[model samples]
Target: MFRWAIIFAVIALVVSLFGFGGVAGMSKDFAVILLVVAVILAIVGFISRGKV
Candidate 1:
């Protein structure tokens, strides 16, 4: 999941560099969403681990 976010972020950067504004924006959004979800899941897993 985290890997995917990095991929999308890199894609966004490359796309933006080439001047594909819309595509880059979409990729950036996906990257941000994936990053948030990954962080949330990681935190949840860490907290749950402490209980067991």
Candidate 2:
């Protein structure tokens, strides 16, 4: 999940560099969403580990 975030971020950077604003914007948004998801999952894992 985190890896996918990095991949999308890189893709957004590359696409923006090539002057594709629309695609870059979507890719960047996806990266942000993935990063949020990853953070949430990490927090959940930590909380669950404490219970175990």
Minimum summed lDDT over a 10-residue window in model 1 is located at: 9-18
Error of 1 at 28 (Å): 0.2
The residue-by-residue lDDT of candidate 1 on 1-52, one tens digit each, is 9999999999999999999999999999999999999999999999999999
RMSD after CA superposition, every candidate: 0.3, 0.4
For model 1, the local distance difference test gives 1.00
Highest TM-score among the candidates is held by which one?
Answer: 1
Q: How many Å off is the CA of 39 in candidate 1?
A: 0.2
**What does candidate 1 score on TM?**
0.98
Model 1, runs deviating above 4 Å:
none
